[model samples]
Target: MPRRNEDALNFLLERRSVSHKTLTAPVPSRAEIEVILTAGARVPDHKMLEPFRFLVLEDAALNRLGDAVADRARALGLDEDKVAKARFSFDNAPLSIAVVASLKQTDMIPEVEQTLAVGACCTSVLNAALASGWGANWITGWAAFDEPFLQDHLGLAAGEYVAGFMHIGTVRSEPSERKRPDLNAITTWVSS
Candidate 1:
């Protein structure tokens, strides 16, 4: 008889992301963020090569990043609307965790596996924040994929890339439940 944590399972089944626009001030404290980060780092890592790291962005840092995003958008000849959209998350966010995929060079663990582990880390962070009664949303935009922005502003190394930018804050409104995929439509049965 395996022990079943029903509450944890229930939370997983009903987990939903709050919009960054709706995430308000009174973000988690440093101590709370530390706990969230601890949960984020507890994902599976093959060969024990923890190939991920986090950057906590708050207050002035968020504003600075937003400004950088706007600049990058303009430099790339993006329209004003595009520029605003690009910087919206940063401008509105109370706090954000940049989940960076810092790959380690090792033949033992494939690059793909390392990348997947980083994704898991991002999900863990999002779930942990949500479970802690805060509004949380995982996001990535053009800035996340732009090499120059990543290297220049975020200081990502050669093999490092953004897995996600997890925004955490107070929930302004309860998000309506969106449509969910039908399990039967997506799942495949396997039997031996």
Candidate 2:
């Protein structure tokens, strides 16, 4: 019989991302952040491509990124409010770990699979932070999608993309429970 880890299952079922804006000071130390990164790197990698990397943004870096986003928005002639909102995640969060998807030129593993691996890495980082008693949220806003902003601020390569910006810090308030999708409606059993 397989051993049942009810506690781990419950944690997974109950885990919900905290808002970046609601996160405050007391960011994780270098060692603690390393732990989170290690956990994140544990994600499954088909063909062992490991086509992803992380950029740890703290203190002045966040503000610099915010400025870069705003500048990109202005250069693109986007609405000021939208531009401000695009940078809201960086402006409010004490620390953010940017999950960068570095697409590898591998015939064995498709580019789509590599992209999915990066997304999994981002989720792993979020879960690691939450399990370690910190407030964490995975975000990807307009700034993340803006190629010019990413190239100017993050120095992303042509084949790379931002999978997520995981904000981590102390929780300011208890987040209210949000509605979840009905599993019955989404699940399908295939017996062939």
Candidate 3:
């Protein structure tokens, strides 16, 4: 008989991302983060091409990125409130892991698969952090897609971009469960 871990199943079934703005202090330590990252790397990769990487942001870097986001927003003619909103995620993040989707040029594996692998990596990271007892959320605003911001702030290369920012911190308040999709409405079962 195959052993099933109920706790793991329960964790997955009830997983919910904590909002970055509501996240506070008491984040995972350096050692703990290393463990989380290690766990995050375990994902499906076609052709053994590791198509993802991580960039850890803390303290000053978070603030700097926040400032850059605000600047970018302003330069784009966004109003004050909109600019502030754009930067809010970074400004409030205690610790964030930027999941960089660095794809390789290969005819064997499609670029879309590489991108999907990166997205999986992001989910793995968020799950790892949440399992480690820290509040976590995966976020990416306009700053993630801005070429100038990616190059200047994150130092991403020509083929790389941010998949998500996995923000980790302590929970100030428990988030109430939001309405979930109805299974019957969204699912189709086929049996031959």
What's every prediction's RMSD, in angstroms?
0.9, 1.1, 1.1
Kindly indicate the candidate among 2 and 3 with the higher lDDT.
Answer: 3
- In the range 121-167, model 2's lDDT, one tens digit per residue, is 99999999999999999999777777777887899988677889999
State the weakest 10-residue window (summed lDDT) of model 2: 141-150
Name the lDDT of candidate 2. Answer: 0.89
Selected candidate, larger TM-score, 1 vs 2: 1
* TM-score attained by model 2: 0.96
Model 1 misplaced stretches (Cα beyond 4 Å) = none
| Deviation of model 2 at 149, angstroms | 1.3
* lDDT of candidate 2 at residue 172, scale 0 to 100: 96
The digit string of per-residue lDDT tens for model 3 on 46-153 reads 998999999999999999998999998999898998898878888899999999988999999999999989988999999999999999999987778778879988
Give the top-scoring candidate (TM-score): 1
Which runs in model 2 stand beyond 4 Å of their true positions?
Answer: none
What 10-residue stretch in candidate 3 is worst by lDDT?
140-149
- Give the TM-scores of the predictions, in the order they appear: 0.97, 0.96, 0.96
Candidate lDDT scores, in order, read 0.93, 0.89, 0.91
Prediction 1 global C-alpha lDDT: 0.93
lDDT of 1 by residue, 23-110 (tens): 9899999999999999999999998799999999989989999999999999999999989997997999999999998989988999
Model 3 misplaced stretches (Cα beyond 4 Å)? none
Worst 10 residues of 1 by lDDT: 154-163
